[model samples]
Target: MTKGERAGADVAERAATGRAARDRLPIDGHGVFRPPADRADPVQIVFDQEADRLPDLLALRHRRMRASPLAFYRGAAAVMAADLAGQPDSGLRTQLCGDAHLFNFGLFASPERRLVFDLNDFDETCPGPFEWDLKRLLASVALAGRANGFGRRVRAGILSGAAQRYRTAMIRFAGEGELDVWYARADVDDLVTRLAKSRRRRVTRVGDKARARTTLQAYRKLTTVIDGRRRIVADPPLVVPVADLLPTVDRIALEDRIRTMLTGYRSTLAEDRRHLFDAFRFVDMARKVVGVGSVGTRCWIILLTARDDTDPLLLQVKEAGVSVLAGPDPVPDPDGEGHRVVAGQRLMQATGDIFLGWQRVPQLDGRTRDFYVRQLRDWKGSVAIDELTPRGLRTYAELCAWTLARAHARAGDRIAIAGYLGRRGRFDTALTEFAESYADQSERDHAAFRAATKS
Candidate 1:
C-alpha cells in the first residue's frame, strides 16, 4: 500500500478504537470528547500564521500529482483535522462545513427565485467531528460581532444566543419526525419578518432592504446578455475580469477544455440538463476571482450561448485537488478531488445544484487537475453580516442553528444527538461557555493575522 493509504488505514483503526494518533486531546467540563485547548485558538493561529501566506497556502492545495486522485479539502482542512486529532469527540461524524464562519452562511436564490439561507461555501467540507463545525461557527460569530463594532458584553450575549439556539434546535429536531425535519426550512421573507419583531428594528429594516436590492442587482448583472454573451463583468477587487488574469495561450487552452469539460459534466446531470448543454455552445471563458479565503484559487467562468440569440447559460469550473485533511489513507481517481466536493455537498446540503459534477483536465504543465462544475451567478448572493445589530445577530444565529440541525439530521442519527443533549439545556450552557472562551481565542488570532499581514 502507498504511504497515504497506509496512513488512512491507521487513522481508520485509531478512530475505530476511540484513540486519535495525536496526544493532548481536549476534554470538556463533563470530561467528554473535546478539542485540545492548546491549539484551540485556530482563528488566532490562522490569522497570525497565514495572513501573509496566502500564496503558499494556495500552492499547497495545488500540489496533487498528475492523474493521482486525492481529496483536496485545502489548508483549512489540514488545520481542522490536526485540531480534531487533539480533541475528544462524541464520535458523531458527518460532512462538516469545515469553515463554517459567519460569512460562509448566506442568501441564495432558489429555483423559484425565492431567497433561502444555507451554508454557501464548501471548500473545507469533509466527514469529521460535529463539534469542529460548532467551534468554527461560534468563533465566526464572535469574530464577526467584533468586526461589527459590538462591545465584549454584547458579543458574549450574541455567542450565548447562538449556542442556545443550536442546542434547542437540535433537541427539537431529535423529537421531530424525519420528514418534518427534512422539510423544515427558513424562508428569507419569514426571517425578515422575525427580525423586525426584535429590538434591532433600524438595522433589520436597512439590512432587509439592502439584501433585497443586492439580490435583484446580482440576478440582473449575472443574467444580462452582451451581444449574446452571458457573463459577469469584473469590478476590480470585488470581481476580477477573467480576461485580465489569464495569459492568451492559457485562455485559449481553457476555452477548448471548457467545451470538452462541459460535455463530460453535462453527462453527469439529468437528461434535461444534458439536452440543455448540448443545445448551447461556448462563447467566452475567464478565470473569475472570488471570496476572501478562496481569492487565490483557480476558479473559472464559462459563458455559453444557445442556438437562439437571447438564450444564455453561465458555468463555473472550480479547481479541486487533494484535501489537506487526507488523514492516513488516500484514494486514486483523476477526478477524486471533484468527487470529494460533490460527495461532501450532497451530504451537507438539503438540496444541491443540478449541474454538480466532476471532471479532469490536463493543465498547461502536462499535469491533470480535478474540478467540479456548477452554474455561475444563478441567483447567488450573501447577507452583509457587518450590518447586523445585536438582536439581528441573535435572530440570524438561531436561523443558522435551525439550518445546521436540519443538515446534521439528514446525514446522522438526530435522535442520539438530541438524546445526548436532552431537554435540560445543559448542552446549551456548555456550548455558550465554549463559544465565549473560543471567541477570546479568535480575537487573539485575528490580531495575529493582522500582524502577519502587516509584517
Candidate 2:
C-alpha cells in the first residue's frame, strides 16, 4: 500500500481497537467541548418572551455582536455553550454545521441539475463536537415529529436509524484510504433506488415520487422570472417585498454598493466564466425576508439583468455575523465575517454557485457588517416538514446524516473518527440517548420561549 494508505489503515486499526492515540480536544470553561459558559445562558427564554417583538429580539441579538465581530463570536459561543450544557457527547470533533436542526436539512440542485439532499444552512458552522450537530439534529427531529403528530416510539425509531447510520458510516470511513474518505459522496439517484428497495409499499413509492415532483417544482419556482423581476416575489407576511422593508437612502446606497460588490466578487470566479459577469448589471435591490430561524436578520435579494430585460440573475447578500454558538466577545479576524460564510459553505458543499463572494458594507448606523453573496434562488428548495409522514421523515433523517458524514469526512481525519466509533453499535446507542434527552430539552426551551413571551 502507498504510505498515506498504509497510515490510514493504521489509524483505522487503532480506532477499531478503541486504543488510538488519545489527544485532548478543546474544551470550554464548563469542562465540555462546547462554547464558553457566559455565552450559553438560556437566551431561548429571552427569545420566547419577546416573540411579539421578534425584530427587537433579533436586533437585540445582532446588537450584542455589533460591538465587534469578536463580540458576536463570543455571543454565539455563549448560546451554543448554553444549549449544549446538559447534553451527552461523542467526544469526536469535526467541522460541524453547528445548527443541524431537522428543518435545516433540505434539497438543493447540484451543478449537474440533480436534486441532492444535504444540510442547507451553515450560519453556525464551525469545528466542534460531532455530538453537538447530532444533538441539534435529533432534537429537531423529535420537535418536528411531535409537531407533525408522530408518536414517541416512532420518533425514537427514526433517531435510532439516524444515529446508527452516522456510526456505521464513520466505522466504514475508518477502514477507507484518506482519498476514499475525502471523495465519498451520496449519489441522489442511487439513494432513491436504495430507499425503494428497502420497503416495497405503495406509500413509499408515492412519497418518493411526490418528493421528486416537489423538488422539480421548487427548481422551476426558483428559476422563474416574474415580469422584469428575477426574484421570488413577496405575498405579504409570508414573502414581504424587499422594497417596502428598506429605508430610501439605504436602498439607494445598497443598489450602488451591490453593483460594486458584484464587480469585486466576479474577480474571484474562474477565468473561463469571468466574461459572464460583465454581461449582467444590478438593476434593483430589496430586503427579502426569509426563514424561521433567520426571520429578522438582514437578508437582501439583488436583481440583475443583461442588455435585454428578460435575462436576469437574482443574488442574495446575507449578513454573516459571528455564529450564535461562538460565545460573546469573540476576537475579530481581520479577513471579515463574510469570508467565514463563504469558506464554510465551500468546505461543506460538493459544488457551489459561481457568484459566491464576501463584502464589508458600512451600515446606516456607522457599523460595517460582513456579508456573503450568492445566487438567491438558483434551484434552491426544501421539504415541507409539516407535510412529511413518519416513515418519510425517518428516511429523510438518514439522508441528512449520510450527507453530513460526507461533509464532515472532507475536513477531518475520517478514519480516526471511524475508529473512535468502532464497528460495534456503542456510538449509535449513545447518540440515541443523546437525541432523546436533547429533544426533551428542545421542547423545554420551546415552552420556555412560549412562557417567556406570555409573561
Instruction: Quote model 2's TM-score.
Output: 0.78
What's the TM-score of each model vs. the native? Answer: 0.76, 0.78
lDDT of 2 at 282: 67
Q: Clashes in each model (backbone N, CA, C under 3 Å)?
A: 17, 24
The residue-level lDDT of candidate 2 at 286 comes to 58
- Poorest 10 consecutive residues by lDDT, candidate 1: 65-74
Question: Cα miss at 384, model 1 (Å)?
Answer: 1.7
Candidate 1 at residue 186, lDDT?
A: 62
lDDT of 1 by residue, 1-455 (tens): 22243335543342333222112232334222244556645434333333333353443323321111111122233454565556566665556777776667766555556666788777666766566777667766765676678888887787767776776787677666768877777676666665545444653554455455532354356545567656557665445555666778966776777778777777677797687668878766665656555655667777676765456666778876555445547565445678778777767776667667777776633577677888775445565676787877777777787777777766665554554454565556666666656555444444443344442
Model 2 — which ten-residue stretch has the worst lDDT? Answer: 25-34
